[model samples]
Target chain A: MRRALGWTVVVLTALVLQSTVFAQIKLGGTKPELVYLVTIVLAFLEGPASGAVAGFGGGMAQDFLLNQPKGITALTLTLLGYGVGLLRQYVVTPSPILPVVLVGASTTVGVLFYGVVRFLLGFNPGALYLIKVAVLAGVYNAILTPLLFPPIRRVAKATRANKVFRW
Target chain B: MALRSRPRNTRLVVISLVMMSLLTITLDYRGGQSGPFEVAGRATVAVVGALQNGVSKVVRPIGAFFSGIAHVASLQSENNKLKRQVADLQRRTAERVSLERENQRLLALAHLEQTLQLHGVTATVIGESVGNFEWSITINRGSSSGVKVDTPVVTGNGLVGHVIEVTPTTSKVQLIIDPSSAVAARLSSSGETGLLTGQRGKDLTMDLISVGAKVFPNEPVVTSGYQGGLYPPDIPVGFVSHVYQAPNDLTKLISVRPAVDFSSLEFVLVVTGGSSG
Candidate 1:
């Protein structure tokens, strides 16, 4: 219960920051997807189930809170959270840069998926523009991963179920 | 058996969540502005917007400080003693400059209001759209302030966008540069009309123009304000940056630079009591 509450607070704070501060600070005409970053990092910290839940909650909050297309973000983030969680279980890399690379790659894929979904909904902005936004947003999110991951990991650890050890 | 069931449960949970998201998307897509999804969205915005308004006020000064730093860093790097003096002077100057700039903008809006005989509520931008897919901003005014959907939002210079969503305390304005936006526009010089549409990260495009219409670069564009239109007539929209005719094309190709600089947009007027037809 505490874990759920903690994660909820994290997601809500991320939503606020994404719409306010990050919205004003655009680099190369793109801002970092702060909620997207938190969702993926949470997925990496928790398992698949927690990841999916975080994704849905975060995405829904973003869509509704920011006047975006209602559920598209929810759909995309749900799948991304689950996939990232599942993928993490199969990979074991000691490289410190793994989080950055994973974040960059996943953000690109998630944004591309979002673009394709928007296109299917008949809001075709253009393929070139979509790719440009996706790529730039990915790089932006990656740059933010280092600053965000440690704190999110700390929250996950603090909220995690206490481990039982047997001697 | 327990281990196998763990993975199964995980997959089951993910599947359920994905299904739930799909259902939401369908409902929201069909629901339009007045649907349950939109109402919930507005409520959420209201709650979050309150928090954001507070944060915006706090962070705005910090943002100004950083921008100020960029201007005076050269003086600071030259010498330590002079650096402190310059920093102090810069801070004071930045505050004065910002206030003056804001005063100028407000004064311009006032002048514009008098010139256009506009009756509207002035609003400050509180937040912006969180996603890259949409070009929109949240203003402090809402339905309570007489800001309704499709109400034209403008700066002192020209048209910015129209209200799309509104709660009691806040509203979202879709900027003219959004890819999905379209405005009914006229070339001020020739009196020829066309449908102006936005391109993502590019200049505005006015199409469906008559081939025989005398078009030229640098022509002023304004709202046509045809019958039952959404914008008031004679509001500046953009200026023709390029005009050309493509082979076998039915209409002239024209690119227009928007009159408003969206990046620096801070204040706008929501034409609440006006004939935007």
Candidate 2:
């Protein structure tokens, strides 16, 4: 319960910032996907199950808050969080750069996946522009990773199971 | 045995979550805009929108500062160009007033409405889309302020977009540059009508011009306001920046530069009522 509550607060705060603060600060014609960044970082700290759950909640919050078509971001972020979490289990690294690299790479793949899903739904924004946004957003999220990941890690640790039955 | 069950349970959780997301997407797609999910989404937007509205007030000045710094180098040249355009427009305004008076007289005699008398609710932009894939903005007005879905939004310069979603306290506007947007427009030069479609990051494209229609660069374009259209008549959309006829094509290919600079949208007028012509 504590873990869920902690992550919920993180996701909600990130959603607010994503829409209000980051939305205004465009870099290379796009803002960093802050919720996407948070999901990946949380997944890295937790395992695949927690990651998928967090992704679903965070994605739904964003989709609803921004009034975007429902479920697209939820679907993308679920797969992304699970994939990153599962991959992290095998690639254990203590380096501080791991979050940056993981976020940059996963954000690129995640956005491309999102573009594909949107294209399938018949909303094509042209291939070149989509690719450009993906790359720039990846770089932007990567730059933000270091700033955000540490705090998320602290929150996760503070909220983890002290006694398994205790809420 | 416990460890084995744990991994299986983890896989089950992931699979279940993925399936749930897929089901949601399917339902939302099939249900269109009137789904149960949309109602709940609107409530969520209202709650989050209130939070966004608060944060925006604090961050807007910072955004403006950064934006000003980014464009500082070109501000002087743009100021000079605007000065020249202002003088030219001042000269033309005198001629335009007389022409407009004559046009009004003719319209009155013919019993036709020349333009929509728009009564608008002014709203300040509070937030924009967080995703890179979409072009949308959120305004500080909604159903309570008489803003509704499909209402036209505009700056003083020209049309910006139309409201796509409205909550109790805020609304979401789908900008004209969004991939899904389409506008019915007519050229001012030859009075030819065509369908204008957005090109994402590029200029708007106007198609279906007849092959025989004379076209020129920089001709003004306005909403056609066809019968039962979404927009009223004569709202400025853009200016034709390029026109060409493809070999053996049936129509001219035209690109229009939007009159409003979407990047700097701060405030807009929402056509609340009385736009009927």
Candidate 3:
């Protein structure tokens, strides 16, 4: 329970931090999908159940804050994170290369998912834009994974310490 | 086994959703746009707008702080500049105060135009819609201000958008640059007519124009008088930005940048009149 609460706080803090710099720090006028990234990270760390719940919460927060369709991002990211977690066997882990590869793959999957959803929903702006968002997001998040994973993993380890010590 | 099955099914569902969304877009747009999907889309739009408004409210104070810092940094050198500009601004304000009186006079002079004059109940722009949703702006004015949904709002340059919702004290106005807004427009130049449709970002798409539509950059676009509308004829809208005649397209695509910058927009005029007939 304490570990779960701690993850929740971490997620909220990350969101606030992400929103603060969104204006100045955007890659191409769109902020990096922080919620999507977090979902992927948590799924990797804690497996699908916690990740799905976290993803759902993140999506709801985004919807409440961003006003996209109520269930859109929530439904999308939740599935993405859960699906990626399910694919864990295909990737293998605790290695540096795995994180690096997963970041690119996850970023691509998330961006493509969002773009495809928006486009399908009759808001097709242009096809070229989806490509731009996917490429930039994939590259930027891939780079960020290396910088972010170790610290996040440490937090997960610390939180899980209590759980492991009892065993 | 059930736990494993649950996760596996979720993967199937996600992939199916991707295909569903893809199908929704393709079929919806092609099949005259889906009704429920449209309702869902509009709901999403409104939700996004409300969300943007909330975000802007939370973040506006931050913008003000940045502005204040910028103001202070520029103050030392801007002292002389401010002194001169302040005098000019004071004169302009006085002139504008009388101009307000003249504005009423002008409205009265054209009795035919009297039906079209704005009866704006003052509203503060509380927040903006998220992302590139520049086509709509949320205001502190609503039904209490007699701002009904679809009431046309204009700023200094021309038409901004229409009130899309009404609370007791707040409403959201969809801007002219949103891909969703399409206004009947005529070129102030040769009077060539077209529909000014908003595109993503800050630009607008002028449609229904032939491939050889004569257009000059910076020429004004205005709302043409439409039956059963609040906006009257010849209200200035925006300037032509670019003209592109795609080699394979039947109609040319023209870009129009709106006159009133929705980004910096503050006060607006919401006309009392809409279609009563």
Candidate 4:
């Protein structure tokens, strides 16, 4: 119950930040996906199952909260969370740069997945622009990882799931 | 034996989650906002909107501070340039005053007062669209404030967008620059009518102008307010920034730059009721 509440707060905060503050801070005409960052980081801290669940919830919140077609974010983030978690279980990296690298790579894949889904759904906005958004948003999310990861790590530790994973 | 079953359980969970996501996507696409998913979405938006409004107020100043720091050098140069322009403008103030009086006299003769007053609720923009593809803003005013769906929204300079969705306390405005947005417009000088559609970014394309019509850069474009049109006539839309020949050569393609800057929008007026003549 406490874990659910904590994740809820974290997701809500991420949604607010994505729409309000980060919305103003545009780089190359794209803003960082704070929700994506939170989802991926939580997944990395926990494991695949929890990660996928968080992604679905966060994505649903985003789909309903914003104006884009529903389910695109949810679908993208769900797969991303699950994939990242699975990868984390197999690959244990002690390198300090792992978080940054993971964030940058995952963000790119997640955005590209979203674009492809939108395109298949007949909402293509052109491939070049999609590529641009994916690459730039990935870099932006990576840059923000350091600032966001530590706090998220702390929160994840407070949750029982984090405790179960450590042993 | 329990450890082996754990992997199986994980697989089952992942498969079920993926299936659920697919089901959501299919339902949303088929049913649209009228579907059950939309009801859930609306509820979520309403609850989150209050939180966003509160947090936005607290964070705006800090955001401004950081933005100010980033743009200080460019702002300084722009400030000096504006100072020189202000001195030049002051020198012409007397001449402009006479022209303004003449313009008022012309307007009175034209009986433009019937289309001038727009009484509506003013709303603050509390948030922006969370998705990348959709260009929109969320405003504080809602149905309770007499802001109805499809009501025309405008800034002081020109049209911004119309309200697409409304809750009791908040509303979503689909900006004029969204690709799906289209406005019927007329050229102020020639009165040539055309369909003005939004492009990818800040640009708009005015199409269907007669091949014989003469168009020039900087011609003012305003809403047609044609019979049964959504917006009232004479609301400033934009100015023609470029003109091109259509591929068929039967019409001209004109590029327009919107008068209101979407990026810096803070407040907007919702035209509640008036003559859309």
List per-prediction Cα lDDT, in the order shown: 0.81, 0.80, 0.63, 0.80
Candidate 4 local lDDT, B63-166, one digit each (tens): 55554555557877656654554454344333543543443443344344345665566677888887676788888878888988799887677888888888
Best by TM-score: 1
Q: For model 3, what is the C-alpha lDDT against the true structure?
A: 0.63
Which is the better candidate, 1 or 3, if ranked by TM-score?
Answer: 1
Q: After superposition, how far is residue B120 of candidate 2 from its true place, in Å?
A: 1.7
Model 2, residue A106: distance off in Å is 0.4
User: B259, model 1: CA deviation in Å?
Assistant: 0.6
Model 2 scores a C-alpha lDDT of 0.80
For model 4, what is the alpha-carbon lDDT of residue A43?
85
Model 1, B105-124: lDDT tens digits are: 65456455455666688777
Model 4 / residue B53 / CA error / Å: 1.2
| B171-244: candidate 3 lDDT, tens digit per residue | 76887777777798888886877888876655788887777778899888888866775466777788899988
Clashing pairs in 2: none
Model 4's TM-score against the true structure: 0.88
Backbone clashes in model 3, listed as residue pairs: A67-B47, A67-B48, A120-B25, B135-B175
lDDT of candidate 2 over B1-277, digit per residue (tens): 6666876787888788888888888888888889988987888778777888898877765555555555547878656655654554455335643543443443344333335566667677888876677788889899999988999887666788899889878999999888778999999879999999888757999999998998888988998888888887788899999987898998987999998888867667788774655
Model 1 preserves the real interface contacts to a fraction of 0.68
Give model 3's TM-score versus the native structure. 0.64
In the order shown, the candidates' DockQ scores are: 0.58, 0.51, 0.17, 0.62
Whose DockQ is greatest here?
4
**Deviation in Å, model 3, residue A81 alpha carbon:** 1.9
DockQ of candidate 2 against the true complex: 0.51
